[model samples]
Target: MDINIERLKSTLMELSKFGYREDDKGIYRPGFSEADFAARKWLMSIAEQEGFITRMDGVGNVIIEYHAEDVAPDTPAVMIGSHLDSVPAGGMFDGTLGVIAGLECIRTLKAQNIKLAKPIWVIGTSEEEGRFGGMIGAQALTGKLTPHQILTSHDPDGIMLSDAMRSQGLEPMEALSARLNPNLIDSFFELHIEQGPVLDQTGVQIGVVEGISGVFKWIVKLIGKADHAGTAPMEMRSDAFMGLADFAYQINRIIAEDGTDTTRITVGKAELKPGFAHTIAGEVDFTIVARDMDETVMENLAASCRKALSAIARKHKLMFEYEQVSWLTPMKCTPSIVEFIAQQAQKLKLNYQVMPSGAGHDSQFFTDITDTGLIFIPSINGISHAPDEWSHWHDVQAGTELLYQCVLTKAVNKN
Candidate 1:
């Protein structure tokens, strides 16, 4: 049940160097980029060396299966993995740690000569960051995204996902065929950094995730007339930027009024057309990201946002449009697996807490078909998706040890 801390650290450090960035102060491996492709290749090489059968799906999900020679092929398998892609200038350990820990678990099981009733699959799902607004890789494997969807999605720079896939030597037309059959997988687990201060602040070494929050994303555009700042009177001008600013302020107020700690609203990206120092902006666009553990709360928040937009548009006399980008309902971990994780944590005498994740992860998608669970270690100061994000190596070891125990217990008990 003990993880080899030194080995885990060494593996993490080695992978950290693969997509390293000099200008950004850390790694910048965006989904489906060259750096991401290189990282996948490296992972496959490692899996091959570990005597695991490896293959990549059309959408570029890498599956490495570790088999017990005595086990029958018809037996359902246990899967442990996380994504390899990171947000621009993201932390080293967020997605990478889970994947490396999964690999390390397999290595440990092999080295210790442990036998199981089922095979183990260590997967490296692509595009969990959704940098292109489509979790194309995991979505493909889970039948959540189709080949046409992948072919049609374009980056901000106008490069199509299909082109990106072809550039990486993958066939885009076969993406739908890559969907992982629901029956093929019995259970899935992901190990991740908490990416929040709760665990570290509370002196907890591990977190057993109960659920992942739902997400509703939208782009709000305000249209007005552009005029010379000096010639336009403040009362006569329909300023798009001004209207947008007011709308953002009201959105915050709405979330505050709701008074739920889990209800969160953020305006992460914004832009103004004809951006200039001397002109009143003609058009403004901003993104809205709202999340909460409760689906009803999420729906209420979305309705409130729509109503706010309508009121703001009328007040400003500006044309308004709100387009839904995506929405995912919250997913709860399987209770039995959650209980098993809790049991294993207690057996290890590890300091742990049960909590809900504020961020979206691949486990949300996996929950659609099979039992899924998530484990978390701490991120220093709740910092993630940036160069300074970090977690202690000891915390990583503790989480991986718990993850290994949880999987072993579950795999053996499967009828």
Candidate 2:
């Protein structure tokens, strides 16, 4: 079955209007914003028009179910979905494309009058961007996030996540019930734009993701005594800023020795206390983000960071503290499902390759409970989370078709 490109484009264009930005290149709707609410309403309306039953879970995940009358109720449902939330000033096609593409896949199946033993569900998972550190709404559905986490998380404006959910008519406490009984879902699939230049650079139209990378985030703090910058001798001063500088330098050295093309460590955010040009810095705080496809490598890098901190503290006569902010284990896509997707790509005569995802996705969370797979279409220049990000309409259409093929195959084969 082939997706209707015209309809798919029209749907994307319509969705774009909700968070429309004249100066920015793509949409700008953050989670739980008024614009986000409007987009969800629009999606629900579309799902209803397609004769699908629409429901939103407690954490604001939208599920549109297409029932097969001839199928047995006990049969596992084939699920296809992605998140709807966008990063701050993100492009239009990042998370939204996967979701709309999933819906389009079902639309194609319905147009062809295809009947299957298992029902199909297209989902729009919430907050995959971690705007509030809640990923894909999967945390709630998978028991990875607690009500306390939701109640405690706040956006930039200090609007608590619980309040945001309440504003959208969702009960935060009830979000725990959103967890899917592990037996209900048979297999999960997500179609996404590559958000990187890999496929576009290689001229591949599709990507069958082998696995998603693990992520480790830390806040490293260096504490030292504050003193007069001019009066203090350079040799006698215990400068926190200097200590942090040396720490960052050592991190670079470690990365140089152990880092590969896929390994990455970033000190993205930093701060120095006692806002004064002449005052000796008393404390320095910085964040570290480390990612790798292999969990062992990730763990080793974390250990290296601790060693670096200890050595730096001993040299600088400063106290060091390393606080772990977050850690997500790597998840590999199911081999059978990945092979099935590759087979469909070949059958369609589409150019494709197997690859690993450098970024996290909602699919990773689903892997804890169900067999899951991911597909990626090219993102022009491999740019995402920015307005300049662009993916050709043809690529989106190709991805949607591949998604349909995979879903259909899984539904019929029950593997």
| lDDT against the true structure, each candidate | 0.84, 0.83
lDDT of model 2 at position 386:
87
lDDT of 1 by residue, 53-100 (tens): 899888888888886898888778899979998887787897889999
Error of 1 at 248 (Å): 1.8
Each prediction's TM-score against the native? 0.93, 0.87
What ranges in model 2 sit over 4 Å off?
A: 23-26, 134-136, 151-160, 219-248, 258-260, 270-286, 310-322, 412-415
lDDT, residue 143, candidate 2? 76
Best-performing candidate as measured by TM-score: 1
Model 1 TM-score is 0.93
Clashing residue pairs found in predicted model 2:
196-382, 197-382
Q: After TM-score superposition, what is the CA distance of residue 126 in candidate 2 from its true location, in Å? A: 1.5
The residue-level lDDT of candidate 1 at 15 comes to 81
lDDT tens per residue, model 2, 1-415 = 5679999999987887877788766677788777887898889998898788899888888898876788777777889888888876788888889889888888877888877768898888887775565373877767788756776776534577888888888888888878887788889999998888999999999999999988877767899888998899998877898887887778667777766567878886678888589999988887788888888889889988898888888887899997675677888998888898999999999999999999888888888888899999999999988888889988988899889888888777655
> Model 1 RMSD to the real structure?
2.1
